[model samples]
Target: MTLRIRRRRFGQIAIATAATTALSGFAQRAFAQRGGPILYGVTLDSTGENLIIQALNLATGNILPINIQRRIEPGERISAFTAISGRFAIATGPRMALPGRRLGRRSRIISSTTEEIPEPQGLDNDAAFESLLNTNDNNLLSIISLNQGTPPFRFANVDRRSGRVNFLSDVDLLPNRRYSNLCQSPRGTTYGTSLGPDTGPVLVQFDFANRSIITGKARILPIAPLSYNKNLLVNDVADLALSPSNQLFALADPTYEGTNSLFIVNTQTGEMTFLRKFAVQKITFTR
Candidate 1:
C-alpha cells in the first residue's frame, strides 16, 4: 500500500511527462462520466520500470490512466488483480492489498498494511496465488494457487475484510492439469484456460458450488498462429476477463520475442478472433 513509482533519469522523466500530459484528457473523462463495461489492468510505464493501472472503455476504445503508479520491488511481480463494486484488489505474490481509490476518484492506497494469505495445509510454502475473481458476494474473493510440483491446483475464498482464507475441497477430476487466467461470470460460473491433451489450449469450467469440474463444457480453443512469426504458436492464455453481458476476452501469451495480442474468445465454439495489440499483464471487467 502507498508504494511510490520510482523516479527515472532526466531524459526518461521528460518522456514520461509528455505521455502523462497526453493521457490527462482520458483521465478526466474516466472520472467525469459513468460508461459501458470498462476493462481494468496493469501496464508498464514507457520506461518499463513502473506499473500503471489503466481503464479501457469497450464501446469507445478509449484508454484512461489511473493516478497512481507503483514500482515493482526486487523479486516481486503482480500476479493477480480484480475490480468489483467500487473497490479493486491486487495481489503481488502472497500479499493482497486494496488500493485507496474508489470509482470516479483519484486513487490512493486506502490501507497502509498489506495482507498476506496463509497457505493451506500440505500446500508448498512457495506456491503463490496466480488468479483472483470477484464473486457474487462482495465480502469474499475467489482465488486460485499456482501449482509448484503439486498435482492439482488449490482453490479457496478469501474474506476481504478479515483476511481469512477458506480452502475448497480438492477437484479430483483435473489431476495434473495446469489452469490459469481464472474468471467468473455474473452468475457465479467460473472459467479458466488450460492445455488440452492434443489440441493445445482449452477452456475449462468449474462449478464452485458443487466443487466439481464441468467436463462436458470444456472445449479446445482455436488459436491462430502469430501473423508476424508463423513459427510461433500461442501456448497459453496470459489473462482472461468476462463482461457482464457474457463476452469473453483473452490476452494471448506474449511470444518469446515479446509480441502481445488480445482477442475475443467464443466460449461455445472455442474460436478466437484477433482484437488488437495488448500490453497489460492482467485484466478484469468492471462496469
Candidate 2:
C-alpha cells in the first residue's frame, strides 16, 4: 500500500534545500551504505477511527500497510506501541479504556478482553502515569510516573498478561530534563527524547536494566524551516528509535508548532542528519 503520511509543506522544501547545502556531508556518511533489511512498524491516526499499522522497508524505502484496526476512542491517538516477536502488538493511549491488545499475524486486531491497568500507589495526586516503552521481553512494559510537582520521575513495569502495573524505581534527571518519547534497545538500553536548552529536542539513554542512567546529554535534532526564524524555539521529538545499524532515528511531533522531519543521529558522536520531512505518527525499526 502507498504511504499515507501527512503531506509535505512548502516550508519543508525550503528546509530541504538548506539541509542539502548545510548537511550534505552528514547525510552522505549516514546513508552512504544500506544495511540489512530494516523493517519499520508505523502507526498513523490521520483518520482517527481507523488506526493504520504499516510496515516500511527502510532499506528499499517501500511501504506495505498491514491493516487498519479500530481500537481507541474517536479523539485519542496511540501514545505508545511495541511489536512483539510473534507478530503480536500492544498499544496504549492517554484516555483508552482497554489500553492493550494482541495483534494477529497479519496485524489484525485479535479479540481479547483486557481491562485498564490501575495506577501505582505512592504517587502523589499531582503525579500522573504515562505509557512508555516495552522491555526486550515484550511481556513487561515500562512506564513513567511523571510528577508535575517534583523533579525525579518514577519508573514502573506493567504486566501485559495480568494488566498489573508495579513500580520499579525513580529516575533523577537534571533540573531542566523533559522527555517527550521513549525507546528501548536490544541490550535493554532505553532512550528518551529530551527538549534541550536553547537547542532542539535530543536523545537521552537510560540503562534501565542496570538501574543506571547512561547519558542525558543533549543530542540536538534538526529544526524545520517553518519554525527556524519565528518565535518557535526548537522542534519537539515524539519518538526515538535505534536503527538496525546502531544509528538513532527520531521523529518530530508537529503538535509543537514545528513542521515534521525525520532525523538520523550517530549514537557515538551525537551528530544528526536530516532524513525527510513528513508527519509520521509512530516509528520503530527492526533488523
Candidate 3:
C-alpha cells in the first residue's frame, strides 16, 4: 500500500529552472528545454519513489502534470501502461486502508495504466518505450510499451520483465514477500533487488508473455574473489537498475562515508560479478 522509500533532498525550480543534480559523479546537463516539442518526465518527489509524474517538453520546457484517475484496486499501479504497439497491461502494489481506514479497503492505487503522451515530432521509429513500477513489495517492475500511439489501453503488448534482479521468467526464484528495491537487468530478461532483511541480491528471470517469472533464483554473484584484493562495501544496496547500455549497477550504502554507490555487474559466467562503481548521486537512462 503506502511504504516509505529512501529520502533525498530536492531543490525548487520555477518552470525555467531545469532540475539538475550531480549524477555518475559527473555534472550531467541540467534538464534541457530550449528547443521544439519537449520530451521529459519528472517525478513529483525529486528523490525516492516518484509518486507524482510530470511530463515536460524537453524542447519547449513546458511541463504537464500526469493526472492519473485510477484508485486502490488490483493492478492499480500500472506498469507497461505506456507501451509501443498494443495489448497493454499494468500492475499494482498491495493496497492500504482508505482514509476512513475501512475494512476491505485494500486495493491498488493506479489503473488506466496507459498514460499516453504525444510523440515528439519526427521521433525515430525504433525507439522503444519503457517504464518502471513498484511491486506490492520492495521489488522491481518494468514494461516495454509499444506503438503507444493507438487505441485500447493505447498500448500494444505489455509484460513483467523483472521481479527484482531476477527476470519475471525466474518467478520460481524470488520470494513472494519481503524486500526493499528491485532493478533492471542488462539483458532486459531479468531484474535484481536489494537484499531482504537477510541481505543478498535476489536475481530473477521473467516470462513477460505469461506475466510470470521462471526458473529459480540466485544470489547476485558476490564481488569477485580477486576483487577482494581491492575494496568492496557491504550491507547497503540503496537502489538497483541497469543503464541504457544494459549494464547492471547498484546504488549501495556502505557503512562508511558515502555509502551511495553505483556500478555495473557482469554475470556472464552464469554467476554475478560486482563490477566497479560510480560516485554519482543518482543515474538514469535516456532510452
Q: Residues 1-287, candidate 3: write the lDDT tens digits.
A: 12221122223233222122112111123343243321222222333333333333323334444333223333122222211221112232222335664323111112223433222222123212233433323333443222221111111122233211212332232232223233443344444332344443443333232332333332333222111113433343444445445565544444344534333445342133433333323223332
For lDDT, the strongest prediction is 1
After the best TM-score superposition of candidate 3, give how far the Cα of residue 129 lies from its true spot, in angstroms. 20
Q: Model 1, 118-232: lDDT tens per residue?
A: 3233334445556777665553334454443233656666655555565655343365555567787776666776654444556767654542255432232323322222232
Worst 10 residues of 1 by lDDT: 1-10
Candidates in order, TM-scores: namely 0.66, 0.59, 0.36
| Candidate topping TM-score | 1
- Give the alpha-carbon lDDT of every model: 0.54, 0.45, 0.31
TM-score of 1: 0.66
Tell me model 2's lDDT, rounded to 2 decimals.
0.45
Which of 2 and 3 is ahead in lDDT?
A: 2
Q: What is the lDDT of residue 208 in candidate 3?
A: 35
**Model 2 C-alpha lDDT per residue in residues 1-287, reported as the tens digit of each score:** 11111043322111122211212132223334643444344455555555444444455454444443335544344555554432323444333224374221111111112223333334443343333454555544444434432234445555554544566434444555455456666555566655545666555555433332445322223223222223332655556677645566766644454555566755644445666654556666532
Root-mean-square deviation of candidate 1: 10.7
